[model samples]
Target: MSPVPNARVLFNAIPQGVPTPGQTTVYDSSQSIDLESHPLNGGFLIKTLVLSIDPGMRTRMRSTEEKSYATAFEIGQPLEGFGIGVVLRSENPDVAVGKYLQGRGFLHQQYFVLPSLPFGMFFLDRHPALPLTTYVGALGLPGKTAWAGWKDYSRAKKGETVFVPSGASAVGTMVIQLAKLDGLKIIASAGSEEKVEFLRKLGVDVAFNYKTVDTRGVLEREGPIHIYWDSVGGETFNAALDNAAVGARFMECGQMTTLNSVGSHAITIENPMAIFGKSVSIHFITSFLIIPKHLEEFNRVVPAALVAGTLLRSPEDVRHGLECVGEMIRAVQSGETRGKAVVVLGEA
Candidate 1:
């Protein structure tokens, strides 16, 4: 076969806060495979099928040289995140052509060559019962994050009230469904009435528009919350702290508000002493950490729940092609897209 034409999105520049179109650029090229010249004797080439657009990518765009949990994207390089793809060429004995796989490090690219499977990489089990997109969304990182937060960290029990902010998000949606399945009473907050209604339909006991409602007041009325699955870390976090029951578990997932801040503005809790009074047990959760620590449990439990229909899979907001990635990222950061924002590269 002739060389494959490839299109990719590159990290053009670091952004001050949320990434804009200027920080990323798209270019086209072509690649050919040669077994003798290949870097990995047993390597494979794959066609990108679905790329995930996550809010966590914002942290990677920071210009600072100091490294956090994730490495900062290099200027003039393809920006990487989670994705699902199909093998187009393979030399590895364990892997074969036409098989689907899931892993990180995919850009908004049409094709990629891999020497070996990276950490957390696995062959996707193509069950006709499940959609391929689910491997990148509910059956992927976001689902595992929720499972780890609820099972390993929070340990919320039956009849206990669990509060989840950003309840319509990829991670939050799973948290709500899992909490409900565990027999916990769920109080969820969303940015819009539409998302609030979406949460209600997903079986949350109480769903409210955090943009308009007085969160603290609502929590005070309906909660002595046993578990607070916090994804939005601004006023909502403080509100949850204020309303936490004694011995409550606080799972800190992400700080979206501070991440999206443009300048020197920072999020500060007015009443830091609130947690002291309640004796809240706080656990900061990074999903990457879960992969190394709890991969076994996550792989066993989450997929079962997904198959059994106990765990609700959020609808995807899929944008077509690599060119739309910047706009998709902006929409996710601005809270314009509902559920998971995914970029479908092309039909596999």
Candidate 2:
């Protein structure tokens, strides 16, 4: 067979803040395998289908000297993230050709070859009822993140009022739906009017545009929140801390608000006494850690819930082709995307 044309997105430069087009570049090339000389040796080649664009990728865009939970993307290397792919050729008996799987190391590439299925990699159990993109959105890491926050950390109960910031976000959207299913009264905040409406449709008891409203006043009106699922940190997080009910649980999921900011900014609480007086329990969640610890529970629950319609799948805002990846990442970071921003490479 002739060499297959391939294209991939490369991390070209370190970003000062939010990444731009110059920081990432698309490289086109061709790949070929010699079947006789290098017959399948416990490896597989996959056709990239859908790529997941996440805010967490920003942290990786920085230099390795800057410590973070994940390793930084090396300059001139392919930018890596979660993506869904179809196995095009396989030497490994465990992985069959034509099967779909979700894993890391997805660049803006047409085809990728892996020596072996890496840790955290799993074959996607094709569900006729669910769209393929849904696996990359809700039923993927985002949904699992929501599950970990509510079930393990927050321990939200029925009739309790739970406040969630970034309610229109990939993880936050799932958080709202899951909280509602668990019978909790949800108060959610978003950046735009459209997102506020989206949260309401997702069954949040109250939805507000945090950009326009006074978060403290909003919390005061809804007072004594039993749990706060904080996806946006900074001032919004401080507000949640201030108004938390006695014994309220606070789950720190992500700090999307100031994630792209270059330098340190003061996010001090005016009254630390409020937290001390309430005996609020605060738990910081790193979903990568949580996902592995609770993989069994997630595998057991999420699929069934999805099939039963108990958990609504988050919407996927897909940008077609590998070239659009940089712009998609920017849109996600800038709060321009209504749902989970994904880059669709090709058909299933």
Candidate 3:
């Protein structure tokens, strides 16, 4: 059998600011795979289906000294990320051939032969009501992060107002839905008018373009925010700090303001002492905090909500093939790719 082109998005060089496509990341399709003869010592061979490019991956492009919860992407190697793949051949009983498996830390390639299934890998539902692409968006890690924040960090009662920054991002989309589900009022913002329009479509109490509006003024007018979904750290965060109500809760996730920081992520807070004055409680949200029951509940409930037309599905920016993967990666790093950015390598 002819060797198959195992194209991959390689992390070639780290960038100081926004990553440059074809420079920071390289697309290499010259590598070939012998699907028929690739080693499978109690292992499996999989053809990549969809690869996810997330904003968090941008941080991993830096040196190992820059520590984070996620492992740094190895230079000259395939960038690992959340991806769905179909088993082409397998010897492991648990890894059935032809089943779609979802995994993090998957070598971003067209085809891969693994010695064994990656840890935490699992098969997706056989007949999901939604497309498999949704797994990389609404049901992906970002969704999980949103769920964790709402379920554990956000201690808002019904009718209380929650302000979400970056409300059009992948995490932001889920945060919007979660707030609605719990009967909380939402005041959210995006960087663009188009995204603001989308937030309005989602039926938010207030949606504004952060680029144009003064966040402090908006929060003053419509908030004393009961819950602050803090993804953007900087002046916006300072504004949130100033506007948070006494005993308010803050769901702290990624500090998106630092993604393209020219130097260090450090930024001066106008009123760092405001939280103390207000007695605000800030909770760090992570999927690790979500137990197995939460995952089961999420799997059961979110699907039903989607089927019942109760949930606003995640907005996605999709691309196809390995060449375009570099483009998407660069777009995400540059904060240009909205919602979830995924690349399709093969069909389900």
Candidate 4:
């Protein structure tokens, strides 16, 4: 195959007034993506198979910075995010061809090249014991996100009860398993009964269907969840706030509400007074903030957890072919799909 131009999906404009599928614009290997044939400058080609479609992308697409964590995507340019791919070609000795890698600012595309950047690093050095896709799930960002939420922000301890919202989603799944490994009693909430059952199979002490289970009441019934991992930020967050025990730690992790275009009203946690009264701390966790100093920590701890049979990677939901990228993303966005939504470009 000759090195032809590459094509990728780009965001046309931030959807401010209405939600239209047209907001995403796709292109064939020409716009904002880097195109270089040489690795002289630490550039490498990636064949993206499974592009991650996440809820946080909703907040990223908005124009507001009041509650956003990362840089907003540039209009008419290819949007960037974490995606799993194979190194098709590499100029840098550190990154070799045919190796599996995970990168940020990666998108729903087939083949693209990028310069070495923080978002462009982190290659999987052939963990023969695990499936290649595990890098995108259990051993990847979602795994790190779950680990940080539990280990750093929540400070979850053995035998303590931990509540995780969006339990069937990517990060939620990892949170459940990691918390379980830590000997914390795991309680989770998923949007559907089927999802709740899925969590139960994962060894959750309690799993509730978010739609019908009166999540706040359920949490109260469960009693004293030491750490509340809020993955679904609107009502579910409010529910967590109501159900938290005194001195409970609340970790603000994600906003699944943004995906539904929920109103931008101020959400005041009554628990703040309760939090202050009980000396509780609310911490925000972002996997991106796991600094270079902490990268070694994650690189060491997470893999060990997987190898030791502590953290488990569930079945991945893969969309075959590059052209199906948009449809795959829609499946995730519409909540019609569960687990890690990805596209496979080729073999590792």
Compute each candidate's TM-score over C-alphas: 0.90, 0.90, 0.94, 0.83
lDDT of 2 by residue, 252-295 (tens): 77776667777753345667987898988988888777777777
RMSD of 3: 1.8
- Which sequence of candidate numbers ranks them by lDDT, best first? 3, 1, 2, 4
Model 2 global lDDT (CA atoms, 0 to 1): 0.79
Give, for candidate 3, the lowest lDDT window spanning 10 residues: 284-293
Task: Give the winner by TM-score.
Answer: 3
Could you tell me the lDDT of residue 228 within candidate 1? 90
lDDT per residue for candidate 3 within 129-244, as digits (tens), equals 68778777777777777876687778768999999988987788888988887898899998778888889888888999888998999999998999988777777888888899
The positional error of residue 292 in candidate 1, measured at the CA in angstroms, is 5.0
Better of 1 and 3 by TM-score: 3
Using alpha carbons, what is the TM-score of model 1?
0.90
Instruction: Name every residue pair that clashes in candidate 2.
Output: none
Provide the overall lDDT of each model, using Cα atoms, as 2-decimal numbers.
Answer: 0.80, 0.79, 0.81, 0.69
Q: Would you give me the overall lDDT of model 3?
A: 0.81
